[model samples]
Target: MYITMEPGSELAWELYAGIDEAGRGPIVGPLIIAGVVISGKCMNKLSTLGVKDSKQLTKAQREKLIDVIYESARYIIIAEIPPHLIDAYNINMLEEDTIAYLVSRIVAVNSHLKLKEISIDAVGSSKQLAQKIREVVPKSVRVVIEEKADRKYVAVSAASIVAKVWRDRRIDALKTIYGNFGSGYPTDPNTRRWIHDMYSLDPYNPPPIIRRTWGTLKTLAPLWYKKKRQTVAGREKTQKTLADFLPKI
Candidate 1:
């Protein structure tokens, strides 16, 4: 990759990368993380496309821009975290680790690209998240973590669009099998109603797509919450019994 630095500039950034996520708060779909890298020269084209934060755009508008983003990006990386993983782990840590994974992967695969900076839309403490990323990325690379970075950086905004588009398609595919759940947000009445109805039929076992650990389930169906607790206790007891049988080392 051709690399250049402005005269007397300390930063010789040749390619800019941005990272953003979608479906972080949704109760139904997978969390989508996307990272986009574009040469400094191509960034003007991205800005000209009129891309903004994905939340500010309509579905049709995002769909229209997805291809353009793909065309303009030097590299686009995406990852999907399933609902079960979200339920089993701390979401904030999961996001942080995933961001590090994406950044490391991008750098490893495109070692030739003179990538210098990465801007991420913050999910938790910006300082902590940057620390996690810095541990894996090259010392020369600069990590920028900011609240609402998607709104401020065109690169982050493009990443947000890519992640959002992927998540929307995944949700649509799920709806074909599970029926419309209306955004899979706890605050969405349609989503709550669907959960209520599903739990009414089978309180002990939620649909595989839904997050079993969500507080919304406990509120809508106490029976489901009770059963989940009981199941967890059973697993713990079984593990203890197995430990007892094992010879102490």
Candidate 2:
């Protein structure tokens, strides 16, 4: 005969988690933070979903897998930092802060779901980002930041999928109002041309969604400054020319 054990006999000790960001490389739109908590059993479910790096999956695939992963995972949290805040602080610091904030929120929401370990796709140097996270997060949680955690870790890949899907949806919504600005990354010629064209028409006017502090903004700055200088010079020259042409008074 076997003896019965107490309830909660199989309490999971170390919970594995993953965190990653999307829209960081984009010249426009907000940055998205995604965090996922996966128990050992849930890992097999993610593999069944064919969850991979967001970059590897097509838009349709990523969108489809998002719902699957959301349902399969133990917990998932996503947060966004709008372009204006990204502009207020540089991307590096903004991302660091966003990740820290997301992790804290996740812990608060899942207090019973004791998470002992977390893995993050590092935005900066792995060492630096990891240290920054530790400094901000409560002393209880242990975090490990790795360069390609999203690629190596199934949980991280799931987080990447959610972040990408959310960000792409936001971009699509913006396009409905603003038209197709392309992928929103600097590498996209269409995005660059759109920035150039918009600023050409009105230097002071920028699409409210675009990050004004980006290098693209700095590139446009010189043109606007040059035009301002030329306008001032032209006015000065016109005044001098008029004075010379005037009859002696």
Candidate 3:
């Protein structure tokens, strides 16, 4: 992808890449991460499209932008992590690693582009996490990770839309198989009600789609598993006590 730096002497990069994510909180669908890369030439077109944070836009607005991004961006990359991968690696760490890898892959593909800087809508926005991302990315390329970067940078905003669009579609697919649970957020009444119904029916084994490790499910454990845990604890304590060892002397 033959790219050149902006005409001005002050600019340093032939390409700019932005990274953002979606579905970090939803319980039912894969977490989607997206990166959008554009030349300085395409930046104005993106701005004119009025890109902003994905949450602020309607579903229709985001869908429209997705097409615009694909047409305008020099390169785009997406990563999706399912429940099993999320369960294996922590969500936050997984997000961090995924973002780092995405940027690296973009740079690798467009080596001639000479990326000036990478903009990221950081998942948790911590210094240590930012450092970890920097560690994996090429040192020649600068990385600027900020909270709410999607709202501030057009590239990041486009990535946010791409990620959200993919997540929404995946959720729709899940709905067909699992039935609608209203966005799959814990705060959603439909999701909560569904959890209650399913847990009551089979406390020992909830649906595999449910993230059993999440605190939302753990909070409900008192309803069924608490008593069994208590009984096991009581037995262990009694067996370890000096009085039990004395044997009715």
Identify the leading candidate in terms of TM-score: 1
- In what order do the candidates fall by lDDT, top score first? 1, 3, 2
lDDT, candidate 3, at 165 = 94
True-structure lDDT of candidate 2: 0.71
Give Cα-based local distance difference scores for all models: 0.77, 0.71, 0.71
RMSD (CA, angstroms), candidate 2: 15.6
lDDT of 3 by residue, 1-249 (tens): 111222221134367789898988866667888888877767777889877889999999989888877877778878877765555554665677667666667777677666777899867546756787676667887788888999888889988998899889888887788777788887888888877877777788766566655667667543432221122422333233222222121
Worst 10 residues of 2 by lDDT: 1-10
The top-ranked prediction according to lDDT is: 1
lDDT of 2 by residue, 1-249 (tens): 001111221237445678888998787887888888776676777887698889999999998998877666667777777876555554565566567666665566556766777788988556656776776556777777878889988888988998899899989999998778899987798988877887777777677778765665667543432121122422332223222332221
lDDT of 1: 0.77
Worst 10 residues of 1 by lDDT: 1-10
Each candidate's number of clashing pairs is 0, 0, 0
Question: What is the Cα-based TM-score of model 2?
Answer: 0.78
Off by over 4 Å in 2: 1-14, 135-142, 218-249
Q: Estimate each model's TM-score.
A: 0.84, 0.78, 0.78
Error of 3 at 224 (Å): 10
Clashing pairs in 1: none
